[model samples]
Target: MDKQIETELEAAAFRGLLTHLQNHPEVQNIELMILADFCRNCLAKWYAEAAKERGIDIDYEQARDKVYGMPYAEWKDKYQLTATPEQMAAYEKRQKEKQ
Candidate 1:
């Protein structure tokens, strides 16, 4: 594929992923981290880094809003659930395994 075509395809796939995440608010960030080792925050950080690579100045919060479909605080208030003890334990186990 041509470079431009490849880039457009990649962008389309990313948008699809973002849309899927937005439609599935029940899939908590902790769950994503535990299962996939990356979450919305991770995506936001990556997005900000990409912006920096392109000589753009996008902060974490701005990237997060783009990912979360709202301000981080508002998203947390509206959709974030408290992780249970079991969830925390699983997360810790996953972190340990990564190290």
Candidate 2:
């Protein structure tokens, strides 16, 4: 495939993934990071970095709102649940192993 076409396809796939994530608010970021080493915040950071590379202005909060489908605080208040001690421990263990 041509490079431009590949980039477009990747962008489309990323949009689809973002849409899926927005619809699955029950999936916590910690769980995602623990398992996949990336999550919504990671996506937002990537977006901001990409924008910077292109000389576009994309702030972290704006990028987060895009991935989250709303302000992060609103989403957290409405959908985020407190993690159990076991979940926290698992996340920490995974992070340590990742280091």
Clashes of 1: 0
Give the local distance difference test score of model 1.
0.96
User: Which segments of candidate 1 are over 4 A away from where they belong?
Assistant: none
Error of 1 at 33 (Å): 0.5
The residue-by-residue lDDT of candidate 1 on 1-99, one tens digit each, is 899999999999999999999889999999999999999999999999999999999999999999998898998998999999999999999999999
Error of 2 at 35 (Å): 0.8
Least well predicted 10-residue stretch by lDDT in candidate 1: 69-78
Could you tell me which residue pairs clash in candidate 2? none
| Alpha carbon deviation, residue 33, candidate 2 (Å) | 1.0
